[model samples]
Target chain A: MTARTPDSARDIPEATVARLPVYLRALTSFAEEGTTTCSSEELAVSAGVNSAKLRKDLSYLGSYGTRGVGYDVEYLRYQIAREIGVTHDWPVVIVGIGNLGHALANYSGFRSRGFRVVALLDADPTRKDEVVAGLDVRSFEDIESIVAEHAVSIGVIATPAIAAQAVADRMVANGITSILNFAPTVLSVPDGVGVRKVDLSIELQILAYHEQRKSIAPASEDAS
Target chain B: MTARTPDSARDIPEATVARLPVYLRALTSFAEEGTTTCSSEELAVSAGVNSAKLRKDLSYLGSYGTRGVGYDVEYLRYQIAREIGVTHDWPVVIVGIGNLGHALANYSGFRSRGFRVVALLDADPTRKDEVVAGLDVRSFEDIESIVAEHAVSIGVIATPAIAAQAVADRMVANGITSILNFAPTVLSVPDGVGVRKVDLSIELQILAYHEQRKSIAPASEDAS
Candidate 1:
């Protein structure tokens, strides 16, 4: 097997890494509309980013648009997908089969975007044997075995705030290294473990702050 | 009423605005744990931000901790909450009562964090009158009346991608100016309206990208 380049993975900025998926999605849309090639300006508009930033981001992947011909959509799309490591399926185990958990398990986007829900787990024994998203809810104790069985590295925490830390700790001990926490509380994880928190309330609170500003300063409302 | 400072709202950067809610949550935790005051270092660790950055963010609100005494916990909490505009309830309407919508409706965080869900709306007529979070699932057509009745300025869209843009357009026309979009689509809103998108898949993809990097470059794994 050929060795992958190590520097390529290390050189991309986190901000650019975050936007790669967005650019991948935009390319998918362009391809769907039967567009084979797109200028940086066109792709930027589709991705809701400016052209210069888009070009700079793509430069990290060593992709440069031709002087006049622009980028080839399919090639750039595959490059981004490979760079994001989503070209192949990544087995994910989700804990906490609550309402939000159910929504996440049922979300078709995860499966379509190269994440496979290998297991559904909950701390409560009463939830066992319950089927969600075509998978049986297993005991949280099964995390170790499931992670070992699937070689899962990414785990989702949809548990309540009180249980989130314990759940995260358990996931870490069992070799999971990445987390997408939907819990409202902050999680303290060890070094090398990546954590991304998604709080719906926080998102709304930000909007309310902006909305309040808009009403208070109508003259600056158009600034956004 | 006395005129408020016109420049305060515009001066705080967007990144600072997003972190204010997080800081508010951290302070709330400290209060619950019987801590009356906290140093910048302590609060920064709780909020998962660096102390210097946290101090700079708080400076925008005209708050500076006493050199040796640190900051009064309750005072800082209130300041952050007020700055985030969550001291008073903001009536919000959520559209699209699907699995994600059901989860959003049942989320206790929204109600506890100064947001009142005035209505749960869905386009499907079959779901009308179904109870979610103790509120009846109203028709999407009722958005206009509900916004008028509650004076709602924020709307949440948990609809499918195909239905999101239309829902956003309808919301904007009805005087709703801010949106928290959960759909997996990009929305184009007119100037003066604000939109914040929360895509579970995008967040996961970001984690996946990082996780891939960790495995590929074990030497750089601790960069996070």
Candidate 2:
């Protein structure tokens, strides 16, 4: 799925890079639906962003659109995927085969996109030999050997908050530099290591903020 | 847990609001460590942001810091929590008692923060008698009754992608205004209904992007 070469790869903003995969996903959907071309406005609606911002994001990848014909869906999809390095599948390790780890292992989205779960490790001895999503759960002590075998650079931490930092330390010691942390605790990592946390409660709290506003506004307006 | 009143609540940016929970969590951690006060730099390092950005974000909530005294950790924590409306517990409903739903129901972070799971519903009849995270798994048909009983405004969709839209439609029809979708699909809802997607694959893809860059840069530089 790799492209010839990426012309404007280095200077993309972090925010824009974060949104490129989203644009790529939207474009892939359009291609699957038999759409050949789409204007920025149409793609923006599908990507859930405004057309102007979409144009700015796309421009960072290089000029791929026709003057009036808009973008070729398949071409744009490949470009963004290549830009995001999803063109080549990356082997990953998941530590802590708990409920969240089980869900992540069974997640079809990862394989469909660009990630391959090469190993599933758990600290519990009972989980050893258990099969999940076609992979056998191994002892957490096998992390170094498994990471060396697969040459995995990215790791997922689904362990408890208390165990998260310890697992992260082990992963980093074994040369894993990129981590996707699901634990609620904040991890302290050395420089050049990338950590992105996905907290389920944080998302709900943000929604609660808006929901509270909707409930309070009417009453306050009436009183005023 | 509520505060006196929130100043400049209406003018806070969505980005800042989203980060408030992160900041609040960091402050709570500091308070737990017996720390009574912290400078913006210390808090920013703990929160994984720059000190200047953290200061600007805190400024939007209110003037809570002194010039040289730094911020009172407990006071700032409560103010941010109140501003984000997490001081009041929010009743929530979970649809799909599958592996993901089971994990979410058992997730202690939700209860410790602001969310309370009132009901767990699934479409499968076999799962009705099952109990997860101490809550009985009810039938999906009970959605309306459960929602009405709990007055739940927020819903979680842990169903498969094929069933996500139908579940969302039913949720919206039953008066759910905000949704946290874990399903790997884009949901279409009526205007004014908020949808926040937490895609496990998207986060992995972002990390892969940076990981890819690190792997490629040295090779390219050597070639040049």
**Candidate 2, CAPRI quality class derived from DockQ:** medium
TM-score of chain B of each: 0.93, 0.92
lDDT of each: 0.91, 0.90
Question: Which TM-score value belongs to model 1?
Answer: 0.94
The sequence of per-residue lDDT tens digits that candidate 1 reaches over residues A1-224 is 26645346647898998889889999999999999999999999989999999999998887546877999999999989988999999999999999999999999999999899999999999999999999999999999899999999999999999999999999999999999999998899998899999999999999999888877774633544
- Model 1: CA > 4 A from native: A1-7, A218-224, B1-10, B218-224
lDDT of 1 by residue, B1-224 (tens): 36655445647988999999999999999999999999999999999899999999998898547888899999999988888899999999999999999999999999889899999999999999799999999999999999999999999999999999999999999999999999988899998799999988899999999888777775633555
Clashing pairs in 1: none
DockQ of each: 0.84, 0.69
TM-score per model over all chains? 0.94, 0.90
Query: What lDDT score is found at residue B144 in candidate 2?
Result: 94
**Candidate 1 iRMSD, 1 decimal:** 0.8
